[model samples]
Target: MFAVTFFDGEGWREGVVEADDDGQMLLREVALPADLPRLDGVIVGGFTDHHVHLELVDVDLLADSVLGRVVDLGGNVTVLGDLSARFVSLRSLNDRSLSEERSDETKRPRVARTSTVIEFAGAFLTPPGGYPSDRDWAPSGSFREIASTDDAAAAVAEMADAGATRIKVASNSDAGPVFDDDLLRTIIELAAARDLPVVVHAQGPGEAQRAARLGAAALAHAPFSERLSDEEIAVQAASVRWISTLAIHDDPERATAIDNVRRFHAAGGTVLYGTDMGNGPTPVDLHPGEVAALREAGIDGLALVRALAPADPRDPASVLLFLRGDADPLRARRLTPADLKV
Candidate 1:
């Protein structure tokens, strides 16, 4: 008999379940009510970090940490795909400047790296000279500047043909011009036709509103430019799922993050846990700072756990994550790298 904790959609129940020859027990048996409520350890499904930059952190170290599933929001897909054991989802950015004069390289979106399976976002379609184009850390083939509906549709096709599972667009204009309403709507409609979700990196005043108005499937980062009004929050609540990268905001901009998250949470927006790990000096695992900050923003033990844990959108019965020993949710919230023995 193997000690296992079970997770059904609600919470974890403890029990002992028989293991197979390979030491793996059927997830369904473990989650059964009769099998639960008697186990010595806690078994939960693996945590899924919806947004992370694997290029910035040590993959080995991250595997040992809390994250079990990681989605690379941006970076070289080949590098992220090579890591062992951990499940990885990659999205390649399309910002390479192919010479129009050079026929061979012109139409082909640069496939700088290759991966086993990548949910590639071919390019970040932004207005001319947008957000990431000028950033020092921005990778070479990461930002696509689109000027019209035709350009937008063609860019989407290029990424799809390049094997992109999804599309990424920059609706943010803090650095420069943003995608106008017409172009934004057209991109959303075209992507929908292909059954692909458009991930938008939206920031500041009009960006979040525009993204929501255009029906973006997800927002790459929590809107930090301003506090979203009830009307704006309602719009987002209708569709968008905010990927929380609160730790990316610096000391000066932390207030903006807190305020925005508060409003989003108040309006019942679905918040998915993410860390822009590669953006700066963040820990390899679930950093205590992120947890503390989230708690301050009104997310506590249960809700926090749900956000961090991998969620199966379709099936309720799936692999569960287990945290062994007597770990209080509040104490877990306060855990630092030193406290994690595993």
Candidate 2:
């Protein structure tokens, strides 16, 4: 596209950004290039679905969605690794093999080395019988049962060896047994040693607070089971990012999460736009409910837009969603990957 429009945290403006056919971005103040034939439609930056489950959802549907990037939070590490292998084109195959051989300690995002980058947490690390372990959706062998701290290092290593860039810890106390503080600390320390971030599925009372104080990179979902206290909210704001899966909730819990996010954002915590896509009725990409839910949690306009584009601003703009009119994320309905111009 010759011209691009983006949100400036105040309002939408034209010509604030430009992109080339190679999908790289240029954030220049100059007007749209008059040389190239003007392409119609308003262009925004690339989109990311901060949380999804490819094992449960359709991968082809995701490829056809608005996500320029995706983060698969929990699954079988080998399964995700096999999925990543499918992304290598003939041109990048040699480079991919070379990088894999060279970077054992380096945990690059797993899904795409070339286009539509996908970062993954590999598998679920939960205490024996915790939350998803009993759920039918969590396939057998995908979750590591941390019965003791003795198994922590090995479990973390298994995921790391399977090409996990980040680790997912399940702290769902409401469902079943959970790792004690010591075990939690052990997992966190091991992940830190590997230079991988830890993403926590913090649920139940005080669980989110614990994950926050312990230095997890982000919570897989905004805590919904209970309202967070001022101290809990502050610690989370100070140390963790909350991926906004607010649309995937029912009342009392949904309201609870919204208030927590509102306070957390007020306390300077970062919120990312994500939908637990496979958990229920969430759309493949840019789910209107997710955008609307984020807006309800007080992340309106530019702040809202920023949540959608969570990656580094200087990152190449390979894929982008084109708006037909005013840069209203909520108003843009039926937007699929087909609507994205790369």
Candidate 3:
């Protein structure tokens, strides 16, 4: 049996425990195998970067890190599809006799590593000439500029065909034109009909409130461009999940976002640890700065670990993270995926 000190959520320290791969939590007290990996650190379940863009990052490079999955929020459909299809056969990215699996988990887990998988949202559905529409970095088929309600439905259907587990809506009014209420509703309704949760990149004055009020499943980023009103914050916390991509921004914006998310977290909103990996310069693995930002937002201990984890029951994997330092993951120095000891 393999050995590790595991944190089964909450607060428990199972020292040097051994367990076999029987899909059950054995936690044997007996001596571990001599050739087995000695993971004496804090072992949490596999991590998932909720918001990423695989088109910009080196997907193959993620193998060595501890991250077990990544959710590609927006990217070129063909590219994303090709990538997923290529990795589809691997039970684990490492391919150690692991096999693809099916379960009751919502989006359907697809392991690409020892237990890693990449769930992708086909493209960013936005208004014509929207934020990413004109951006040089966003390639063709990466951002679909929907014209009408029916058009939006068609685009979402196309994404569904492309194997997007959820829908990503670009409601960034600050960057350029975005979806109006009617179009937004069309997209949301269509996505919901397909059982896809809509994640919005809500920015600027009323965009956050609009997305929240319209029942967005999650906000791609913490509402940052403007400070949300108490009512808006309440609505968002009550309805939307927030993907924490806090470390990429600097003062004022970063500070404002942290404050808003802190309130949301306190109000019981779900917060997933995400780095927006390719938006700027960030490591290919778990980000310590992002982890630190989450701590500063008042999410510590088990909550922090949960945020860093795949958090979604639908995307569970068999891998584990063995952090090398402090048992309290919040104070842990070895937080990056590269620093993962086993």
Candidate 4:
């Protein structure tokens, strides 16, 4: 038996649940308030990782990390499917086609037990020559370039048919045309028609602004490529949710990342905690730098927890989070991953 503070969709309360020999427990509303003994340890809901690439990071090693529920922002869905089978508690997938490909059929990518309950964003939609096409590390078959509004709508339908739960689009461009407003709007509308949310890769000047104006559900990274004005910040706060992938900015542009986060938080924008794991030589799991950077940007305690909580686009009411040891409720607002016990 273990004592834990359970967080249902509504609120938190003390409860006891039995764990198996593997320290695993399944929670459902039906088994609540039963007679149970005090627990040796409490597993607050599992850590919800907003961004990660489980395939790139060692699956076994990441399974031991603090994060319990992870969302893979981008990667090879087939690889993610294979990893999902091994790690039943790990929840993530990259696209619908990969999900369909893995369904009780071929088994090139064996599933891991911990890889159950994954949600995929499908292929990334970008201009013909956008940010990912040039990247040597971009996984093949992951980029879907849309040339027009009709193409955008068709792509959304195709991904939906492939069983995509969400749509991913890229607005940033390093060498070619960025998605025009018409195409962006079309993608969002089509995704909305399918009841899927859109996640956009927003960077470069005006990218974040455009995403906000176009009602993008979330931005893949903090707007670090450019400094947003107060008006722009307000616009973003009113709309798009920004995922804080601050650790990726440790390059010479660290200052930009910090500043972007500071202004975004100050403006009351939603910040989802994320580390672009596998994008470079980032830490394999709950990155202390990313947590520290969020603290530096003025998010603390409940705010930080909310940002780190795993998000389900379909079920906005469902959220989960965890903290090791007796984390000070007040100190949680200021804590870095270094301060956590596990």
* Window of ten residues with lowest summed lDDT in model 4: 330-339
lDDT measured at residue 278 in model 3 versus the true structure, 0 to 100: 90
- Whole-model lDDT, model 3: 0.75
Flag regions of model 2 displaced more than 4 Å.
Answer: 1-3, 6-42, 90-115, 310-317, 330-342
Output the number of the lDDT-best candidate: 3
Best by TM-score: 3
lDDT of every predicted structure (CA atoms): 0.61, 0.73, 0.75, 0.63
Span of ten consecutive residues with least summed lDDT in model 2: 105-114
TM-score of each: 0.74, 0.80, 0.81, 0.75
C-alpha displacement of 307 in model 3, angstroms? Answer: 1.0
lDDT of 1 by residue, 288-316 (tens): 77777787788765677777764331122
lDDT of 4 by residue, 51-112 (tens): 67655666566544555567776665555555555444334332223334433334433211
Clashing pairs in 3: 92-112, 92-113, 93-112, 93-113, 93-114, 112-116
Kindly report which residue stretches of model 1 are placed more than 4 angstroms away from their true locations once superposed: 2-4, 9-19, 30-37, 76-122, 311-320, 324-342
Q: After superposition, how far is residue 119 of candidate 2 from its true place, in Å?
A: 1.6
Candidate numbers, best TM-score first, in rank order: 3, 2, 4, 1
Superposed Cα RMSD, model 1: 11.9
